[model samples]
Target: MDHLACFTPGDLQSARAPDLSSYHWRLLAQGDSWFSNATAKLNAHANLLQELVLKEKACVVNCAGTGEALAHMVDLESAPDFVRLLSSPEAPVWDGVLLSVGGNDLIAAAQTPAHTADGKEVPLHLRLLRRQTEWGPPSAGVARYFSEPGWATYADYLRSNVRHLLTLRDQGPSAAKPVFMHCYAVPMPRPAGSEDGGLGSSGPWLYPALKAYALPGADWAAISRLMVFHLAQLLKAMAADKAQFPGLHVFDSTAVPLALATPGSSGNSGDWHNEIHLNHSGSFKIARAWSEHIQNVLAPPAPVGKQR
Candidate 1:
């Protein structure tokens, strides 16, 4: 049995959906390359968390994830397709949904200033304003062109999309299902040149972006760390607002000690395949965290001893 499956948007539309009712835990999500690569190796004995859960007869199904694809399926704009897939006879009510969004969205926005006409990054304040307003001035007839929106806009969208998904599920068969998401682990902004034959020379993935927007006179590494820290905080804030939304949980993988140990600091690139994705050892660590979180959520409550 396949523990993980990857799908493209087209693949999802045309392919027959699988019956997930028999599985102990059903998961729905769209992640970047990290989720794809990690889960693909999950069924093997090498994956510590996967093996542990397998003992409890746990099974998981990965719906769709691909490199560079925005994990925007939770957005309201994706509702039609999401409904079509979920309503199919083969689909089942999910136990949890793992959301792997926002990271790539942030990365894209980080690079936007470099790609602009004048090569001047939009002021952080103005960019934040645009996002806060939800991209502003709704025009029905005008075709949206190639203007770059800021990360804050995407952040707002991510939060809104999650709420929409929750509402949709709340009205359906999966009302009790919990939503799980993770904070991206920190990465050293370095190039993966021919020295490592893996995600080759994806030169300075975060460095250039951080350099472009970092505060003047600030250390680039510190800037990168701060950026990552803020992203983690954003996720935590979203998870903590339980009064506003329920059944939402976040796994703070970023807080794991080794995650912050960049090359020349506490460790080297041995834990990384590239500036972005993790190597086997690194992926295993993240997977273990995910596995533990899932197991804890699925565990039955201890019997309450009656007051004697």
Candidate 2:
């Protein structure tokens, strides 16, 4: 809501792409709650960076939907222009594209209790842990979210979507564009109810599933960390393959420093507003980090004629 003037209604409805002819630099962002963030106003972190930090005319199209629906909303074939600026004869080359996805995908799958090979229900975090018996060598973690038929299937889905985005960047009307993706911030799983209009109004987000697996409330902190860390590991692994994804980068929002955890501090926490979403202060911390990262990306290349 912060920059209602920045995006037209069509952009919000995903009906028509925004016109980018007037701006010197443009960015197309596609993803979920992290970027849209209805919970917090001033959802346009891009605008904040452009105004206070970069001091440039940066046009942003926020096509972030819910986690369950985001991938499809920005499908390469469906929304080809969702992650690229509108092409005009006089338009400057796009500065970059930002993708804030994958967290919701993982979150949805994680909340489901997957059945193990032995017909036992297991939480996602425990399934990923290496286990061994006294009589045999250690076995690897459940191939992936145990419910999934095969881990390769999910990996393929992620690979295909991301590959398509990178391909889009390469084929832009302008020169090759940088593609940046962000990892979700670490969220703690506390049992605070929605009494104060916290995210708990949505039912503790991932708590029911954790409870289904009989995980103790005391262990929620460690489990929460494990789940988030696992997702980060997967993303970092993909980003490390620079050969396969040139100019692709990840903004590690998970690394943002935070104050100590306080009891009964649901919305008061300096880092999180609830289990899943960040409060205003928390959002700014991340937006600032993103601003710095983007500034580096948008830096102009040294001039060839100035070599002397």
Candidate 3:
């Protein structure tokens, strides 16, 4: 991966080392833990950006950080560095932008406790999942655990923020250049917290949220899968609607066949470093598939007269 050079916002802005023109592709990356977690120094625990091996030499100026939500990422006040590097006069002409957001936002929303108009508290109706007592019979599948109105509100919020992000990109030097995003793979509900060699630990997000709603342990995986599926559909819809999100490309990372983590694990299991983040093997698989997809998209169209 020597062909790939990654820099923090400060390093890229101040030094601008490794002349930008040297790379075949110059990209800007912004997102959450997937893009910027430094819990472990080993390559095995490197974030998505560090694991990427593109078809051509590429340099990425990363403005992402751990625990950043989509709303914060899109906010000018919260993301001044990202804003400046993207749209300012001194901004670079990036070949593309890579984004890894919405995951944290979803988690936060799921964990939100329901509140009454009178400011009273309610435990049965969480922001995303309804309590088991409110669920339909087991035959209802994953649909039984979900709150329709809650999901609708969340969907609207996600779409609106994504549109805001697109607007920001259009205002930048990289206007109309491809902006690539991914639908995250489904993770099993577990007690796995990302103990990244003790740098800092966080998560088991969905696990606790579901527990608070008294969801059955056996149904955790199915519930999580359905949630991820819906998210993927939303992203696909945005990509298809060129009128709204032109040049937006979404990689259906969920389609990648990676091993699943065992339920109830407190540490690394299968390909997962924890509950939400992927370990080296899993990340590599996803990165390779995504890289190939991007390469195909960037390839020039065949000449009209040429046919096999």
Candidate 4:
């Protein structure tokens, strides 16, 4: 297989051929709010995947949602029933399984209310304490004000979710077919405070990328590394459990050395949009990572001809 180096999300979808529209592959996509942008892109990619795989009848099923939503994918409403669902495979459980999860779990777990010194509430301060992030990069969230210990808890949740997904992958798939996923993207950070006294305006839209506060007491640098650690751990676990999941396909989209290593905050910048949702370019950036990973998993070198 030759190497594929550069691409944006648009290039991925736009590059498809008319003949590429017929492949059908069963797919399920899910992620927290951070992945909302990528979800659409992944669906488009799935269409492409389906088209390519169509010589052998298949279709993609997009299961995009928040972590809160993912818990329910297996009917979490009934914990016991959900457990049963995990224990058994139902219809359309064949072919391929594409996932984008864990981000929502991080977001969901990170959400907590802030309190005053006397246990009273401060609206502005509470917002900070809650870490009420709106996606983009962690550029504008309340990371700075957060203490080292609290951030560590958030890190635990991130790692736990990845482990959980791997267990599911090993159990559900027939052990032969590939289960693919990417390392969720990290939000670009802004200078500690960039809004009305550091937090800027709580605008519905993120025009000027937010620059949040960097509190002295918090563990700023280490926080970002934690996400990568979880991703690495996930990959390592999968790699080590060779027999458990023989063909687990994963791509390290966690850090972009090729593009947007330094995400900009003005005029659409480079890759990020708002902090979480990626622009077409950003999505493609990830898609490019995905494409190469898929190429290796499905084929060392994908032929121009249809993939059955």
Cα RMSDs, all models: 9.1, 6.4, 3.1, 10.6
Flag regions of model 3 displaced more than 4 Å. Answer: 1-3, 37-44, 66-76, 115-126, 197-201, 301-308
Ranking, TM-score, top scorer first = 3, 2, 1, 4
lDDT score, candidate 1, position 126: 29
* Per-residue C-alpha lDDT of model 4 across residues 1-308, encoded as one tens digit per residue: 22222122233247551221344434444333333323333332221222222223334433332122223122333333222323256523435555555554433333333444687753542231233342234674433444445445554554455455556655664335676766666654432111212222222121121223223223432444454445456655664565654556666766654234243343234554434445556665666657556656654555768556
Evaluated with lDDT, which candidate comes out highest? Answer: 3
lDDT for model 1 comes to 0.53
Tens digit of lDDT per residue, candidate 1, span 1-308?
Answer: 22333333344346574444445666565454455433332321122223223225344444443222334335435334445434344445767766666676656555555334865646553232122223324361111111223446666766886677667667666675788777877777654421222322334556555444432323444444555666788778888998655888888877665543354332236566556556567767776766677667766445678434
Q: What is the TM-score of each candidate against the true structure?
A: 0.68, 0.69, 0.89, 0.52
Superior by TM-score: candidate 1 or candidate 2? 2
Pairs of residues at least 3 apart in sequence or in different chains that clash in candidate 3: none
Per-residue lDDT, model 2, residue 73, is 21
Off by over 4 Å in 2: 1-5, 8-22, 37-52, 65-93, 115-156, 192-201, 260-268, 300-308
Off by over 4 Å in 1: 1-21, 37-55, 66-83, 86-90, 118-121, 126-154, 193-204, 213-218, 259-268, 300-308
Query: Between 1 and 2, whose lDDT is larger?
Result: 2
lDDT of 4 at 47: 19
lDDT of 2 by residue, 1-308 (tens): 12212453256457565556666566666666566524322341222222214546666665552222324324445443454343333333656767776766665555554566688855434333212221122252322223333334445566767776677666656546777777777677665434333332354566666665555556566666666666676667778888777777777777877553454455446556556666566766777777667767777545889755
Candidate 2 at residue 35, lDDT? 62
Q: What's the lDDT for all of these models?
A: 0.53, 0.55, 0.77, 0.42
